[model samples]
Target: TLSQHPDKNLHKIAHTRSSTGPLAERVRPNQLCDVIGQESFLPESPLGRLLVEDNLPSLILWGPPGSGKTTIARIICRVTKRYVVKISATKAGVKEVRIIIEEAEKRCALCQPGTVLFLD
Candidate 1:
């Protein structure tokens, strides 16, 4: 279930899972500058500029396992200070999307920060 205050768990989620989760999670980069191998998306690039402006548009990150898709999403959420709602597209149906959208509408009505619908 989506929490009314999703941002409340942002810090807790990032810190708590890294300690006991997989090695990859434990060593994941917390900032865009710390990521390697994807230099095209780093600072000085268009994506980097957008991130700096905090105006990153809806994007789709497609990559194989072990890639930095989730890591990038986390960094975006943190940098933008937005609520994140992660959903697995493979398993998600219209029902899930409707729920997320509805929650986003509520947030917007309240003048809260935007929600990042990170479809994994």
Candidate 2:
């Protein structure tokens, strides 16, 4: 009877829906609590504590592939209420950078929190 059930394919359908996105995109953490590792570089660290409190200075995150740099950047921007404009250095040129800066300036002038230019 189970083999002849009309919903026999339900599990396959659920699996397909759950695994729709790319592996990396699907697994990317949406918040700090979901992030793993890099504990020493977080607010707990001496140097990082100041940055976390102020959340003002521009940061340059350098690390190997899959090192959670993007995740950390996202978390910082989210916590600071900053807008994020992601750009790729390899594809973006001076013109794009200038445009982003001008837009950021306008947002800042409006008393918006700030912007984080995540250069990937």
- Native-to-model Cα distance after best TM-score fit, residue 61 in candidate 1, in Å: 0.5
Candidate 2 residues lying further than 4 Å off, grouped into runs, are 1-18, 41-43, 46-54
lDDT of 1 by residue, 15-80 (tens): 566577865575567888777777756879998988888777788888898778888888887788
Candidate 2 structure quality by residue, lDDT tens digits, 19-119:
87754564466655456687655567764575567565777888898888888877676676678888899999999999999999999999996888988
Report, for every candidate in turn, its global Cα lDDT versus the true structure.
0.79, 0.72
Error of 1 at 89 (Å): 3.2
Structural similarity to truth (TM-score) of each candidate? 0.71, 0.65
